[model samples]
Target: MALRAVVRSLSELCITVGVLIVLFVVYLLYWTGLRADSASDDEIARLHKQWAAGPVDGGAPGGGTPEETGGSPSRGQDTTGDGQAGGTAERGAAPGTARGTAPGGYRSGNSFAVMYIPRFGGGWSKPVLENTGKQTLRKGLGHYTRSAPLGAKGNFAVAGHRRTYGDPFKDFPRLRPGDPVVVTDGDTWYTYTIVARPYRTLPSDTGVLDAVPAPVDEAATPFDRPGRYLTLTTCDPEWGSSHRLIAWGRLDATQSASEGKPDALTR
Candidate 1:
């Protein structure tokens, strides 16, 4: 009888701990989701206030400068050579700009303002300035620390939770070939088109998302160059993140603020 009583008490304790963990998670989601929508001046202002107010190099800087990062054979060059869009990583372009490095345009403090995914049905999230940090990745928009600025000549990567914090990519798989993903700063919007689905690659598949992402099917080599690509990742289970699911896209069109951005594009 004593053993039975102890077992029941332990079970009750376990349940209590589980409940507390869930509550903590709920709070985390609330804070992160609040910022995932489209980037707005008001949003920026608030973030600036939270960040203690100062100009931040928009996008993520952990990935390094556009030219210094994401330029290896792993990224794969434009095998198609269509020329409509080669590749971009120009500095100062905006958050989530093209991966191909575009020299000479980069300036600091506000590269990307917003991110658009029609898969999410026009509702987008604002791009935030960040550096590679454990806290940043856990929140949303992990800076590459070693990559270029957003829209610079290299890749600037961001990460978010798959099940919590509104799970920004909850519907990301809905993106089809030629579907568009747009990122906008205050003045211009850079566009990307869905080219590939998330394929499992070794963590070494760095060049593609690196200086360039390497071909998933091929070995790492510069000549294996494919084209500029964007890899969107999230936890696979939908309910829990165990393995990662990645979605790929290619650069498409760019628009100025006057062009009328898509409806539901911003937060």
Candidate 2:
């Protein structure tokens, strides 16, 4: 009878252990994602508030607007000889030739810009924090520090999780060539056109973050001059990080935030 009792107690212990394991899995998969979403929302709200407040003359924390800084239009604006509004001109620098300058130097975990992918959905947008570290990615997409600044003449690369955390790039695989990936620095909307299909590479590959992402396929070409480019990197295979998937794009247009949402964002 004593031996039987010992076997029954062991079975109960096993059952308890199994239950705790399941609960831990649930916490990692669901609770962490909820936490990430809440953090991202808070960061975005803070950025909007800063932009709404407008910048201080030359000493503002977020920097001044293009007009105040003597910079060109964030996006191309068209006007006839009489200064009346004309339709958007071809995607190029405006007469004064100013592009969206970096907001200011940001710390590792601070959000500096917002990203919108119309291909994902009209409502799809994410905060872009300054660093690619684990903590920054958990809050939102992480901008690679060595890459170009947003709306500038080099590869503006960013990284995000594919499945866990908020799964910011869960739909990354659905992006196709010609799709629009738009970014805003609170003052301007910079639209990028996806140049080709996503290609897979080893996680160790850093060329994907080059000034012009090295051509992966026939669709890509090396850019000799300074040109606005973008590169998105995420883990492949949905649930693992054995490799990375990359998508490339080039700036197609720029518009003022005062003009309202860009056509890529509209229905």
Candidate 3:
């Protein structure tokens, strides 16, 4: 009789432990997402406050004098090469007015820019923080430290969580070729078009962050030489990190923030 009782007690203990393990996984998957959403909201609020207070010294690099619209200097022009002349505005300088210098040194938690993807829906945007560390990514997208700054003649790469931490790139797979990925640094809006379908690779494949991402297929290089490029990265399978999904884009047009939001944001 004692042997039977002992066996029953062990079985009960095993079931309790199993239940607790399941709960922990649920917390990591769901609770962490709540925390991340709250963090992202706070960071975006901070960035807007900064913009409203006027441009910060050593703000984003690559700003230049305002562009000429008609007879006077305007905030910015639609340099998209599509012949759509953006009207003048009372605020912000034009693209290329500020030279592309080294971006100011920022710590891990600082919010630097706002990224918009039209294909993600008209209201989709996320705060881009300085570093791609555990803490920073929980707030929003994390910029790769070694990559080029926005609108520069190199690759500006960023990473975000696919399944947790606000899941900033949750719909990454929905992006199609020719989709627009727009980013603004308070002064200018840089628009990049998706060059091709997203590619998948092992987590160790760091070449996706290269200045010019090497061609994945034999359909010619996306951009022949080193020009402004943007790369978005996230983990594959929505819940696993064994592989990575990458999206590539090239700078297509630029406008001043003062000219109003880009069409990507409006549509």
Candidate 4:
């Protein structure tokens, strides 16, 4: 009788452990994603509301001067909130300027733009927040602080999560050359065409954020000259960050927000 009792207790304990593990997995995979998705949507809506209200203090329609908006760090510094300090490109244009105008500032942790990838589907859009910190990425895609502004003449790099935090870039592997990644700063719509499929590299390969990312090999060279570019980065293996995945693109076109949505988004 004692042996049977012992066996029964062990069985109950094993079952309890199994149940707890399942709940943890659900929280990580489902609950966290739901929360992140809602947060991203809220950020997008906030940006739209700000834009509709018009530019304040002569800044971009939805932006303000860095002093007023709590701007990010200057160029060549670690604005990503990550420990690395590598980017050397020119500072991003002040927030809220049309193409060809002087660069504006970015309020760290704030959403300055919205990105839509038709390849990801018409319903897919994510807020592009400043600073690629751990907490910033949980809200949406995080822009590399020192990279160029949208449609600017330098590398405009952004990062997102692959498996959690709403899995914004879970489809990172599906992106291909010729795909379109459209972004808007409430004043202009910038369309970028993917120059090649995703590139995988070590997390230490900060050159990918340079004014012009160096080609990994002779045959895979994407850009050889300075120009406006787009880069999307995420973790590899869907559930692991052992490697970094990247996608590069060039500014294909730009249209004023007054002109209606870009064709890349309409079609």
Candidate 4 clashing pairs, residues 3+ apart or interchain:
60-96, 93-103, 93-104, 94-103, 94-104, 94-105, 95-104, 95-105
Q: Tell me the spans in candidate 1 whose CA falls farther than 4 Å from its real position.
A: 1-15, 21-112, 154-156, 202-204, 219-229, 239-242, 262-267
Q: Sort all candidates by lDDT, best to worst.
A: 4, 2, 3, 1
Top lDDT model: 4
Which residue window of length 10 is worst by lDDT in model 2? 73-82
Candidate 4 least-lDDT 10 residues: 70-79
Off by over 4 Å in 2: 1-6, 56-104, 215-226
Query: Candidate 1, 191: how far from true, in Å?
Result: 0.8
The models' CA-based lDDT, in order, is 0.49, 0.75, 0.73, 0.78
lDDT tens string, model 3, 77-177? 22212232332232133323342224433334566688989887777789887779887888899999888888888899999999877677889999888
Better of 1 and 4 by TM-score: 4
Residue lDDT tens for model 1, 1-267: 999999999999999999999988777677555644423444444433423211123214445543244322212222113232322333323333343233322222222245667776744554443443444444344435455544554454555556555466677556566677776544456676766655544445454466465546653222234444455655566675455555656556666656777543543
Residue lDDT tens for model 4, 1-267: 999999999999999999999999999899989999999998898777656654342344325553333122222132344343333233333322332223435656767789999888779999998889998999999999888877778899999999888989989999999999999988789999999989888788788888888745445557989999998999997888799998999999999888999888877
User: Using alpha carbons, what is the TM-score of model 1?
Assistant: 0.57
Residue 247's C-alpha lDDT in candidate 3? 89
Error of 2 at 91 (Å): 30
Q: Candidate 3, TM-score vs. the true structure?
A: 0.78
TM-score of 2: 0.79
Q: Candidate 3: worst 10 consecutive residues by lDDT?
A: 71-80
